[model samples]
Target: MALLRDMTLGQYIPGESFVHRLDPRTKIIVTMLLIILLFLVETFQGYGLIALFIGGLILLARLSPRFVLRGIRPMLVIILFTLVLHVFLSEGEIIGQLGPLKVTKEGLFKGGMMVTRLLLLIIGASLLTLTTSPIALTDGIEAILSPGKRFGLPAHELAMMMTIALRFIPTLLEEMDKITKAQMARGADFETGNIVQRAKSLLPLLVPLFVSAFRRADELAVAMEARCYRGGEGRTKMKQLLFTGRDYAVISLTLTFAVIVGSLF
Candidate 1:
């Protein structure tokens, strides 16, 4: 339950910081570039540089470091599994032994690097949502995709769907948490068995969750219809988005830093 509440992926924290003030389009493009840079990064030094960059962003955003990182808690199991898999399966110079399994230096390095990459990726993405509002994010996405409208692309519709999906993530998680607690109160056991048993235990949870999700979707559709919410065909935004000098400077600096880090390390 605490884990669900800790998730900050789709939740926005209102602030008057530099990051929060940037044009959403600039932030979106920078985030995409950072993601691409992550894939190109192959050295610890490069990762370190990227980490510093992200840390600077966090500072500029005036966000709590602990809050920004709390989202990683839910992913710890998967990250640990990845590390263990790499350590035991990858063949290299043996460093130690755990029973019949051998630990290798190369494996340790690869696993650590992979874990760092994942952490940075998550933090970068989280920062984007934390600083930008849902409406702004939708506008940024729609604007970026608008050029494709010539090819019959429904840019506005796609952007709206994406934003709504992100917005619902936390809502769904909270719903799941409530359902779990309710089931536990009724003597349901979700944590007492082997992997297979535990999975089977979730059957009851999934059924109700799905039903709830569908119900919410139906309700949302009805609400939108009631409000006469049409697609972007004749839509005009209440708040216009325009890039400023700060946005251009941030974008330029980010690109330059990414290029240098990619080339140097």
Candidate 2:
């Protein structure tokens, strides 16, 4: 469940561009809208439209495609695996058969659709994270959950936990990488071992990581209490959130697009 704490989005880089200035809530909402529309899209033409729309977003955010691709590089292997499985194993009207395996037009179409859907999901969500700051994202979450706090929902506490978790993801990843290397240098043999042996090799790395994470949590809790930190109650924001004309324009466009895509399917 480390991902429960880890931020999947890219490290937020603050800029004075049009994207950075939009209200966090608006950004979050638009991102959700985009993802929903992405799944709603059925035809290949619809997917193309979504791709162009996302490209426009990346352009608006002023981020390089190289950097965005870097964020998704780690996921490519899994995506490829999925694509391969879908392409080879799926059953359809026989286009060819060899050694108990069949390749067909339906299989090809299904596999291509799966791969395309996955790519759209990953890239679209990555765009959201690439453009939004952690603090702003947390604030957006808290604002969305504000109403639930009236029923003792612990909205602020959850947000605080998420904030700490997001903040430490990179640090923990570096630590894990270092720990892995250190174990390797000690003849841990993680790579060459059988599945069970490889799994066993991870214990040396994981125990210390868990211990360190627990210690950090304890220290952070103490530090928060020492500073008289409380929940979101009665706390005023340093920056007031406001929706701009650009936000309205983006939302209207997304909603319209979503309706069109739904109708197309």
Candidate 3:
């Protein structure tokens, strides 16, 4: 349950900070640019620059560093697995040994760099959901995809689907946690077995979770129908999206930073 609560990727925190006030489109674009930069950079110095940039954004947003970083807890297993695989499997000068496995200097460097990249990517993406509301995120994504409407794209539907998936992440996690606890109270053992056994133990939990998710979906659909909800055709937004001067300035600065970082170390 604690682990589920620590998951913040799909959660939003309301605030009046500069980052929270930026146009959703601006935040979305900057996040994409940062993710692109993360993949493009190789050197530690470049990663350091990106880290600083993200840290600055966190400060500007006035978000708790602990709260922001808690989002990484659920992904720790994947991160560690990547590090272990790289260390044991990558060929290079052997730096150490564990039983039959050899650890190489190159492997260590590569693993550390990969882990750093993953962390930065996670944090950068989390910031988007942390600061932007679901409605605004949907609006921004739809607007970005609107250009494709000429090619028969269902922009609004696509955006809504993406947003809903993200929005439901925490809800589903909480539901799973609750079901796990309930099953455990009824003498179900989920943590006392090997990988295969533990997975099998989850069968009971998954059954209830799926039923709950389907029920919620049905309820939401009925509620939407009750409200006379339709697709985006001829629909209008109550709060129109407008890019202010601050948005332009931020976008320009982000692009300039990306170019400079790409050209430099």
Q: Pick the candidate with the highest lDDT.
A: 3
Per-residue alpha-carbon lDDT of model 1 for 1-265, expressed as tens digits?
5664667886789999999999999999999999999999999999999999999999999999999998788888989998998888889999999899999999999999889999999999999999999889889989989999999999988988987897798799888889999999999999898999999999889999999999999999999989989788788888899989999999999999999998888
Alpha carbon lDDT of each predicted model? 0.91, 0.79, 0.92
TM-score winner between 1 and 3, please give it: 3
lDDT of 2 by residue, 1-265 (tens): 3443333456676677777777788888888888888777777888888888888888888988777666556677788888778777887788887777778777788778877878878878887777788888888888878799889888888888889987888788888888888888887876776899878878999998999889888998899889877767677889667778988988888888878876886
In model 1, which runs have C-alpha deviations exceeding 4 angstroms? 166-223
Q: Model 1's lDDT to the true fold?
A: 0.91
The candidates, ranked best first by TM-score, are 2, 3, 1
TM-scores for candidates 1 onward, in order: 0.83, 0.86, 0.85
Ten contiguous residues with the weakest lDDT in model 1: 1-10
Clashing pairs in 1: none
Candidate 2 wrongly placed segments (more than 4 Å): 1-8, 150-153, 170-192
**For residue 59, what is the lDDT in candidate 2?**
85
Go through the candidates in order and give the clash count of each: 0, 0, 0
Candidate 3: list runs displaced more than 4 Å: 162-198, 208-212, 215-219
Model 1, residue 146: C-alpha shift (Å): 2.2
Clashes of 2: 0
Cα error, residue 181 of model 1, in Å, equals 8.3
